[model samples]
Target chain A: MTDVNSVRPQARAETSVRPEEVLLPPVDVIEDAAGITLFADLPGVSRDRLGVHIEGDSLTIEGRILLPAPEGLEPIHTEVGLAVYRRVFTLSKELDPDRVAAEFNQGVLKLRIPKVEHAQPRRIAVQVA
Target chain B: MFYRSLFPRDVLAELDRLQRGMQQQGDVSPSIRGTGRGGYPAMNVGSTAQSVEIHAFAPGLDPASLDVQLDKGVLTIAGERPGVLPPKEAPATVHIDERFSGRFRRVVTLPDDVDPNAVSARYTDGVLHVSVQRRAAAQPRRINVV
Candidate 1:
């Protein structure tokens, strides 16, 4: 089993001065023979408001969720407040960062990271005596 | 089990603290206790003179598959989300799986004055907006001053 801690990236200091609170979006990371796939739930985030960046060994995802209040309505109860989503993950050498692909739809972001050629599993041939 | 047994009171207190923290963060719905998972799809409920509006933050769900029903002043939203992994490919191993999938249903009771017959819903981006008009008698009206 791969040690997740070894490859996990550390969060950098907050530099932006945005007033909105940043939230940690829930994510799922799946690793197969080919590579890893990451899915993040970012509700109310549109394509223009989503950002995915990779620098050095860190992968950062940032998104803003905007839910405008309707006119002439009074908020009686609020459970989900508007906020920004921000999270970062570390990348391992076994995977190729250049091959990463991302897709955003219906408030969800899916990222595909392909493994290096040698990192994939292979079948071995038997030798007869 | 052994740790809990050894520090029963401490564990209970810690659990209570954590619950309180989660509640203060508004991450978990009070109705769904013990689920412990933070809000998956946060929601907001508001009211106006003529109608009540409910907004549920759920994305990536098939619009056609989304189920919204109102019965006896209770509104229920249910749907299924397929696994994020590609269907055709077989995964050799899974490292970190945190995303919640499968089917889920959330039911909330509406105000007694809501008009069940007058209801409309729309799904945009990932938010689900529901509007239900209030009963005619329940609507506020101006009174004439003699």
Candidate 2:
């Protein structure tokens, strides 16, 4: 397991100007022979409010949460305040950026990034004498 | 290697003590006021004139799997989120595993004025919203001067 603290420095550097709180959504990244897949937990973010963009080696994910206050209700007790979620990852060149597939359901976002043809492993056959 | 496992428990206990000390200093976040426990799935509690609303910020949990219960005045939320990787296959090399997946339960005591019979809950996107109506006597009434 990659230490959660290790990934924060890079993401924090990317969003230095924002005065509002920028949450680092918890994520799971799995890498296999084919490629890598990333799953991010972004509760309260709807489909239209989510944004995923790749610029060169940097991959940034942003989600806006809209929480409407119920009518005629004065908030007596408040805890979890609303804030936008943002995170950035530095991607390697071996991953094919154009072929990425993404899906959002419930409150999780899944992104699949395939490896380039040359980056995929190939088995060789043995020749008989 | 054996010592590493034992070391964390001591470290964690120390950290907990330090956090408690910090909380006593009045620097803790107000939202976590009643719910003293920390880590995974933070929550918010709010109240209107007629109802009390609790918003649990838990994502990636199946809606049907969540268990919500109200006993006396305390509300309990329990659920589990299965790990993303397939179990049968060889473990894929993980780059990061910050997302926690396991059984979790959070219980918070509510005020005595809430009406248990008039509770409603809904799960949308990834938030579990639980609203319980308050008893008539608990609501604030405007006084008129003749």
Sorted into a CAPRI-style docking class, model 2 comes out as medium
Which residue pairs of candidate 1 clash?
Answer: A9-A90
Which tens-of-lDDT digit does each residue in A1-129 have in candidate 2? Answer: 678767878787887876767878889999988999999998888999999999999999999876544776565444455578999999999999999999998789999999999999888889999
Instruction: Compare the candidates by TM-score and give the number of the best one.
Output: 2
Candidate 1: interface RMSD equals 2.3
TM-score of chain B in each prediction: 0.73, 0.76
RMSD in Å for model 2 = 6.9
Writing each residue's lDDT as its tens digit, candidate 2 over B72-105 gives 9999999998887656467578888888788888
True contacts kept of each: 0.77, 0.76
For model 1, what is the error of residue A19's alpha carbon versus the real structure, in angstroms, after optimal superposition?
Answer: 9.3
Error of 1 at A97 (Å): 2.5
**Candidate 1 chain B: worst-modelled 10 consecutive residues by lDDT:** B28-37
Q: Given candidate 2, what's the lDDT at residue B127? A: 86
Q: What does each candidate score in C-alpha RMSD?
A: 7.3, 6.9
Error of 2 at B70 (Å): 1.0
Top lDDT model:
2
Measured by C-alpha RMSD in angstroms, how accurate is candidate 1? 7.3
Give the per-residue lDDT of model 1 (tens digit) for B44-131. Answer: 8898889989888888888899899999999888888787654545655566666768887777778899999999988876888899
